[model samples]
Target: MSPAGASLGATVLCVLAWAGLAAGDRVYIHPFHLLVYSKSSCERLEKPTAEPAPHPSLTPAPIQARAPPVDEEALWGQLVPAAQKLEDGDQARVAAVGMLLNFLGARLHKTRAEMRGRPGAAVLSPTAVFGTLASFYLGALDPTASRLQAFLGVPGEGQSCTSRLDGHKVLAALQTAQGLLVARGRAGGRARLLLSTVLGLFTVPGLRLKQPFVQGLARFAPVTLPRALDLATDPDLAAEKINRFMEAATGWDLGSPVMGLDPDSTLLFDAYIHFQAQMKGFSLLAGLRDFWVDNATSVPVPMLSSTGTFQHWSDTHSNLSVTRVPLSDNAWLLLIQPHRASDLPQAEALAFQYDLPMWTKNLSPRAIRLTVPQLALRDSYDVQDLLAQAKLPTLLGAGANLGGISDRELRVGQVLNSILFELKADEEEPPTESARQPAGPETLDVTLNSPFLFAIYEQDSTAVHFMGRVTNPLRGV
Candidate 1:
């Protein structure tokens, strides 16, 4: 038989064997024996027996009683007023503000989890915390009033402070969850830091005392929302301000640039100066500004001096100048100074050389003396393309497939064989010179009806250099 035919036969036998195993314990009879039995006795094979079911009384019993349903409306009625009062009361009256905010945040998180298909939490936890804090600071809640009397089966003026206190408790839980999520990189860490800082400002009195320094530091905080949203959401602003204050107080700059300077570089002189100021309990803003000025004088090369020009001061002034050369789309070139005749010939032999794409001359030069014009970077994929790529099963399931495949059964060397067989028989070939050429790379689709069966043949082909199967030609087996 041909190789393909042999492969097909082998695949059929393997599949039948697999199917038999899948069917569980079963007797196999030879064709001759079956024929002899049929001829001697006109009786068919006996049917298999079924297992008996257990008695209802003997089965495991279910729980008898359940907890009573919570009265959500009554609970809400009790909680809302206290929450409002606590939010509207003076800061002095609401001493345990952190506990209150945290409680509300937790409740919000639980509400969010309950609403599985919803976009956000039923109660906006952050907003609730902000509102509660605002209410307390604004003096809406009075300490003399009975805030919990109406909700807990107690008869009074119907003001339930417990409800408001619950809101704060929920808020606290939500904040904890948020912290965990941010730490895991699920939520933005920077945003979380800012939020924490803002909350700290309200809870920590000493930080707010130095408002000007805090505000200055806040200016450098990452812009979470646009200017309009920033103004509308007071919590966001407060959070950013608090973040700035914390960073300043700790002598750490969260907004420091990541790429440019080496860790040991003198450019961090400003950071050192700020650290000294922080140690002495000086105002952060003034210290930072002074540090920058001092650093500019100390390390002139790294600092951008106010000379109305962008220039890097080198250690040695040579006749030859170093200029940046633009390479291709994603490359850069630095042209070193060419030595003069007075200098050693070795100096002209190129002080530094690095491998880069040879197509560096294609980029146009910018008019600025020492600056390169911004390159118009193009995205490799459009929105539709990105969405389609994201939806593909192959990329999503690659990890699972890798985990399941045994190295002994399937080696990387057999991948090419699998790919070749994976190509369908009816798949159109690449256009030749005689045929009308395709504008782009030709694409083909291969569908597998039974991928597991094909995988067995693929393993066989990898183990032994032979074509696997043609059991389902249309399915690319």
Candidate 2:
């Protein structure tokens, strides 16, 4: 698979893979707190009993293209993804999730730099993008589908001999990760992280989308809408409707990008993700700290400080310091800051050198004091540009078989992945002043007062679910 394809597949798998890691029991490597997905680590859940069907491929959906969105509401369908009753213990699962995490970390850094990784935050969901490609894969045929499979990694018993992947099974793993989050109901003991994902399909009026493609979409979003849109006459209006649907579904006033759909449009696709995790256990510092965007520029913002037995380490080689702190049972935050005040840009450049898992694996722990800005990332970007950066610009442009989206010679419309990641401390109740103090005699003092990169990752899968840099905490919401 091309690097772009592999990166895209890893992104798709991340949807569920990142979320599922929250429930499993895993050991934290001291200093770095990197969680290795071992058999012993997954004792909380049983091994998957049986593999899903092999080569559960979708049929050619050459339905039609030049239709219009007649019944928008009725067009939406309910998605009932098969409940994951069995947990597959195959090593392939680990390898698949691990591959996705590494890809995600690389993409995160790349995107961050592209967006100017300072004075603002950049966020994107890998699995959400991956989900779109999977949908396209279903709509594609022979060579197209096969090529997509290479990027999406493997499906079913990935280790077993199989010419193709079961798209449903691969998507199911992501749902498995999402399942871990909701398993804890809100009443007795449940998390407050509001993580939601939704997918939308817009077709020209009166097109018969394949049941197989629709069924495949159900694996990712419970409600997959097949709407009638007049791309030829009113493409912008159609885009508006799609945006409104996304905002309504997510209960956030997040309108989507105004896409330049072809006037002779057949199909368009969009994915929405809304995630916010308010810090519950940590105490907020009483005053705002100065965040340096550069040696000359600074911004004042609230900060969070803590001292505890976190796995902390400094790499003199990279001139970077990293500390891991638990955000939730399912989420761990890796706080990274440069060792020298002048090495911020150099540290950003070094991100390309370390596959996060490998770089983190080498970290050893010690008691430390860490202070971070009260940060949140509301980041969005065009995947097309990102694809171009990956050196496969026209892969989704012309002659692409996005048939699973619609039966006709579908044109790839605006494919956008938007992410909303916000962090808040002392949500339910105020933390005591003592809770804000360091819990141990600190060995290292790492203060993120300048341009620094950080990620909230699922330890088990090592998936960097949320990644961004805070150069000015006062910038992005």
Which candidate number has the best lDDT? 2
- For residues 133-153, what per-residue lDDT tens digits would candidate 2 score against the true structure? 666766676556655554454
| TM-score of candidate 2 relative to the true fold | 0.73
Local accuracy of candidate 1 as per-residue lDDT tens digits, 140-244: 122211121111111223333222233223233223322221221111211111111211112211111222222222211111111111212344443354334
Question: What is the model-wide C-alpha lDDT for candidate 1?
Answer: 0.21
Q: What C-alpha lDDT, on a 0 to 100 scale, does residue 374 get in candidate 1?
A: 12
In model 1, the worst 10-residue window by lDDT is: 273-282
lDDT of residue 125 for candidate 2: 62
lDDT of 1 at 217: 22
TM-score of 1: 0.16
lDDT of model 1 at position 381: 10
* Each candidate: RMSD: 34.5, 9.5
Clashes of 1: 39
Instruction: Give lDDT per model, in order.
Output: 0.21, 0.57
